[model samples]
Target chain A: MKRTFPLIIAAVAGYVMVVAYFMPALQQVREDAEEWFNILAAIAMILGGASILGMHLRKVSDRRAGWGFSVVTLLGFLVTLYVGLFKVGVPPMPEYPDRAWTGEYIAQGSALWWSFEYIIYPITATMFALLAFYVASAAFRAFRAKNLEAMLLLGTAFVILLGRSYAGTLLTGWYAEEYPNLTLPGLTDMIMGVFNTAGQRAVMIGIALGIAATSLKILLGIDRSYLGSRNG
Target chain B: MKTETIILNSFLGLGVIALALWMIAWGQEGKFLGAQYVEVRDTIEVYDSRELAWFRTPDPDDPEETIGYWVERAALPDSEPPELADPEAGDVVVEPADLDRFTPARTWEIQRGVSRDRADEDGVVLSLSRTIGLWFAAICTLFVFSFLYRDNPFYKFAEALVVGVSAAYSMVVAYWTMVIPNLIGKLLPDLVQAAFVPEHDQPFYAPHIGVLILSILLLWRLSPVGGWVARWPLAFIIGTTAGFRLIAHLESDFAIQIQATILPLVVRDDGGFNFWMSVRHLVIMLGVMAGLTYFFFSIEHKGFVGKTARVGIWVLMITFGAGFAYTVMGRITLLTNRIEYLFDDWLWLIS
Candidate 1:
């Protein structure tokens, strides 16, 4: 009953949504259905939060490697939650000064806001910055010119690397005024604008067709793997 | 044990960091390598936040009236360092007769499209706390970068804390923004009051009891016995997204793209044949057709089909290489930003 019930809901919702896209009368149904999904998604946050908390708690209980980091994670989570939920250090909105708890949760000097600015902002920036080092490492080790295909890729990469930056202009810009076609930037633009778009479009078309087929399979209950098994 | 590989790696890593620090110092002096950057010293005016409140202007012909959202209440931010003021800006005289023709959404689209950085903020003095914030931010940045040397506790702690804080923050945002405003606000406006939405703006429609039931069923996954109930909402979400996206993908990815491929290969100017442009067009057409043919699995890739497939592979390779190079350049910019922040904002070494 549990399994069949969901399958019926899926097939109905799928057909309705598709119909609504073209049928004006069913547009309101589409709007209401989307709202339901949004509400469901918001509620699903609890499930995500539970998973994070559970994992960290288990790590602490087991005294796992870097258990201390798990403690930090839990502490950070609780601190953010407490400060935000209680509106700690946040001032009441200018118009609603008399209200007890109604205020901007991220008011300038608020603890939550400050934590976000100093800690989260910096960490996110730095984590992404780490990519620079990784790219360099990959270039040194993994990027090898072993064959015709590899050589062509390496040559294109070199041209793009030079062309996008100021150095390319310095090298090619002087001569580019006469023979613009042969210039680094010109070649780079052609490669990206024409060659890249063709490949990208081809891939996108294939992906779109694959998605259509998969969605159909799921709609028909032929793809029961998502429900854990064929029986489920 | 200390080995040659370890020593070499240590030297290389530390050398790169040292070079970065030097670049920052040099950048402070407005010189990198031999190149000198000119800094402009000028005054910049900050606009009042009230300007975006309504589509108002100082002209008798365009007197402001309190008309619904046609007169916007949402205030734009005060132009900061990043959001510079437009040097070319002047008091504009608007005609309400002209504005009345546009829908409020059209007016909004036109207004929002105006670039923020069109404004120039050259001479505004930096705040003390802003400078201090940059210094602290740099330290955190360095801590993360230290993972390049070797993994340690600082990087792990920072990573975990960022994850925890972001997850918690996102949860709060979702509850207040989505659940409260859309779902709870409509269902129990009397109970939630104006917390979910402004009292005046609350929906007049009947509470969607069906959605509420579905939402509760969605959360039933937390209950071990009622886990199956969650699948109903999951299936609905999946199916709806699929059904909706199919048409969207067909319109955008398939039909439109296919339409785009049907183009004239020959290029003609006002009088003569444009040989170069025609060649470019021909190459583009061939590339697209070849690439698409490569992905066509019905036919065996032999003879002429194989050669076309080979060309397609080369085209794909060029695409991937360009993509990789673009990413490398992007990563360089991020690193450059931190370095610039260190020199310009934190250190105050640059004017």
Candidate 2:
């Protein structure tokens, strides 16, 4: 019964969502279901937080390798959670000066806002920036004109890289007035708009068909993998 | 560490110290990196009443000719009065005193002359917290970038902090933006409106009770006992998402793409027989068809199919190359921005 109940719930929910597209009256049902899903998702985040805390706590308690890092993680998590949940340094709304909880959780000058601006933004941006060097090094090592396909790929990449930068304009500015289509930027635009779009569309269509078929299988109970192991 | 590594580290440290010293000297010469905020007192003119007197005028819809009558509000006392003209005869005379006879056309609260008076230098000082925040950000950025050289304690510390903080940040954001506003606000409208959202007037949705119950069940997953019950909510989520995506993808990706691919082989314009446009359309149609043919694995790839599929492979390669180039460009732009932040905002080395 443990697995059967969840399977029934899945089938019913899936069928209802599919059928709602045809019947306008069932639109409210679909919206309500979506709302329920959102609430569950939010609750799932809390579960995720708990899981992280539990895992870190276990590692710290066990005195595992890099336990100091785990301590740092716990401190960061708890401090951020405390400040955000309690709305520390967050002023009350202008209309509700007497109500402290009425203020925005991430209002300017709040501790949470400070953490986000100073810590989160810089770290994430720098992490992404570091990828630039890696991508360049990877391209240098991987790109080779061994075959017709490789040559085409390499040539297209070269054109795109140049066209996106100021150097392309400097190189092809003279030809732009006479033979615009032969210029780097013009070729780049053509490649992106025509060939790239065609390839993307074909891939997307295949993915759509695959998704539809899988969804149908789930709805009909032909696929019950989402319910997890039968032993449960 | 190797002797070479120690030497390199020493040189890097000395370079950073030198840059800092130069920045300090530059700041002493009247250029600084911190933000300066100003205080200003605003002067506003509030109207006594929302009611405004209006008059009938010729419609200004067409520039060359007046077609119909249009009702306009009375001009402010300081502004020029609008000229009332007859639509057909082109002229109508109305006395200034007669303007008051027109009925009030609109009710709107208007505030005018909202000017600001800037305060003195005392109000233009830098924020200590903001300066400190900038320094912290700069340090964190350096720490993250340190991973490029080699994994170190500083990078690990920054990584851990980011992971923990971001996870909690998302949770906090979701709680305030989604759960509290949508679920709690709906379930207990009066209480939420009184304490939180002053404008919230959502009627209690009975279905939200189900949502609350499901949320509780989902949260039960964190507990040691009866964690298996969370499967119900998880299954619902998976099922609903699958169903929604199925229709959405089919309509937007499959049907629409196929529809768009049905292009005219011959194109014409106002000048007639646009050759370039015709070639572009032909290429798009043939490209899409060939690309789709490559994905069709049911038929053996030989003869005509093989040639078309080969063309498809070339198209796909170009697509991937272009995509990679765009991604690299984006990442390089981000790197450039970070460098600018360091040199301009942190060190004050650049304008």
Question: Which structure among the candidates has the greatest TM-score?
Answer: 2
* Residue A35 C-alpha lDDT in model 2: 81
Candidate 2: give the clashing pairs: none
Cα-lDDT of candidate 1: 0.68
lDDT of 1 by residue, B1-351 (tens): 569768867987996797688768867865342221222232112122233223322233433321211122232333221212222342332222233333332110001111112223443322333334445566667678778877877778778888788888877777777776677777777655644223426754574777778788877878868588788888878777777777778878888887887767778899888887787777777887788778888999989998898888887788788888988888888887766655554444553
Residue by residue across A1-232, what tens digits does model 2's lDDT show? 5787887888888888888988999999998888878878888899889988999999999999999999999999999999998888776554443344777788766789989988999899999999999999998998889998898888888899998788888999788999887788888888888888888887888888899999988877888888777665
List of chain A TM-scores, every candidate: 0.90, 0.95
Full-model lDDT for every candidate = 0.68, 0.78
Range of the 10 consecutive residues with the lowest summed lDDT in candidate 1 chain A? A92-101
Query: Using Cα atoms with residue i matched to residue i, what is each candidate's TM-score against the true structure?
Result: 0.76, 0.84
RMSD of each: 11.6, 11.3
Docking class of 2: acceptable
How far residue B91's Cα lies from its native spot in candidate 1, in Å, is: 33
Query: Per-residue alpha-carbon lDDT of model 1 for A1-232, expressed as tens digits?
Result: 6778778888888888888989999889988877877777788887888888999999999999998999888888888878877777655433322232455567554667767877787788767767988998898797789987787778889999998887788889988979886799888888887788887777777777888888788788887655666433
